[model samples]
Target: MIGNMEIFLIILAALILFGPDRLPKIARELGRAIREFRNSLEEDLAG
Candidate 1:
């Protein structure tokens, strides 16, 4: 399991890599992709 410090460091790395402007857009896209993937998985299980 990841701890708080690890998560902080990952966020810091992301900030440094992507800069401030594009991070939120990238994060939102990632979230949507994850949600879609999870929904597909549930559909497959139900069917």
Candidate 2:
């Protein structure tokens, strides 16, 4: 719960800093990066 609150705060800060126009593009790129990182980590663990 506390961690979620912190994440929410950070997201709010990012939105303020980046503005509405850039935030969606930033989020999409961030999501893709996270997905790629998780996939690579899983592959490493399997190997």
Candidate 3:
């Protein structure tokens, strides 16, 4: 499990890099992109 300090650092870095307004949207898009990539890999493996 990730420690609280590590999580806090990650959040801080994200805030610094993305700012408050864009962070949530970027996170959501990144999550979606990762999910889609995983799904595509699974489909390829299945076929």
The lDDT for every candidate, in the order shown, is 0.97, 0.95, 0.98
Lowest summed lDDT over 10 consecutive residues: which window, candidate 3? 9-18
**Of the pair 1 and 2, which is ahead by lDDT?**
1
Best by TM-score: 1
lDDT of 2: 0.95
Candidates by lDDT, descending order: 3, 1, 2
lDDT of 1 at 32: 100
Which RMSD does model 2 reach against the true structure? Answer: 1.8
How far off is residue 33 in model 1, in Å? 0.5
* TM-score for all models, in order of appearance: 0.91, 0.78, 0.80
Which pairs of residues have clashing backbones in candidate 3?
A: none
Q: Candidate 3 lDDT, tens digit per residue, 1-47?
A: 99999999999999999999999999999999999999999999999
Judged by whole-model lDDT over C-alpha atoms, candidate 1 comes out at: 0.97
Candidate 2 residues 1-47, lDDT tens each? 57988999998999899998999999999999999999999999999
Q: Which stretches in model 1 have alpha-carbon errors above 4 Å? A: none
